[model samples]
Target: MIDNRDPLSRLKAALQVIDSQRKILSDSKSDEMLVRDLSAIVRYLNSMSISQASHILEKAHRRGHDQKKNQAEDFTQAYNLNLDDIQSIIDSENVTRGELESIAVGRFQVPKGSLRSIGNMEQLKMKVSTLVQNERSHQTISKLAGDHKYK
Candidate 1:
């Protein structure tokens, strides 16, 4: 139960618990502890005012999103699809510009007009190959940065 008499104080107390748990998990480098602490934080935040929780939550979400996007881009690069070949395939398949994104990601939910724009199975396979290359490149970069202090 939140103490309405001193809501700010209650929030601060919850924040203190979260901060301490985070410190402990970080220092010990324990994934299990980190997960537990993160769950606890989420639970605590659920009762808090949106204005109070938005700042930290947004920052965390943005960082995670950027990391995922970078990983995807790296995968695309590793697929080794030359620009010319990729463009040619897209042109030859009459791929819709909007649906092109879906096809690139192996998600083909093409609508009526876009249905005829899909390339042959072979061409789709080539696009898949390219996507994998980008993913692999991203993984390599992530590994290097995390494990080797590489730029």
Candidate 2:
């Protein structure tokens, strides 16, 4: 329950919880802790129940994870690259426009549609280099090996 009896204060309190909850939800591992967080964010008498929110959001997160997993699987299947080779391309800054585009639009879903940068090698290299620096690149590299699936 909101500590404040005033209507405006109560709304402000809920807003504060919602703001904090947004950050937690984004980073949460979808564990039991999420239930506690939601319970705190929304008091059952005031708004949506914790159970309903948890079920919906957890399902959405699960679907998103599955989608990313499928996309990564398909990308690695097509590329079949060893980690050393993948790293070499990233380090060389000489990766092809097609390869960069594949990773960007196909795997990372960086703004769908044909990027004008894809036609320009220098631009493509810069974009892909940025991508390589991201955690997604590291995760994708870990998926390849000497192997085809993600760990």
Q: For residues 8-106, could you state the per-residue lDDT of candidate 1 as single tens digits? A: 555566777777777677778779766676867757775677566656556666999997787566445534555455555565655444334444543
Per-candidate TM equals 0.25, 0.30
lDDT of 2: 0.60
What stretches of model 2 exceed 4 Å from their correct place? 1-85, 91-94, 117-119, 136-151
Candidate 1 ranges beyond 4 A from true positions: 1-49, 81-151
The TM-score that candidate 1 achieves is 0.25
Tell me the lDDT of model 2 at 23: 59
Query: Whole-model lDDT for model 1 versus the true structure?
Result: 0.59
- Lowest lDDT sum, 10 consecutive residues, model 2, at 3-12
RMSD of each: 19.7, 16.5
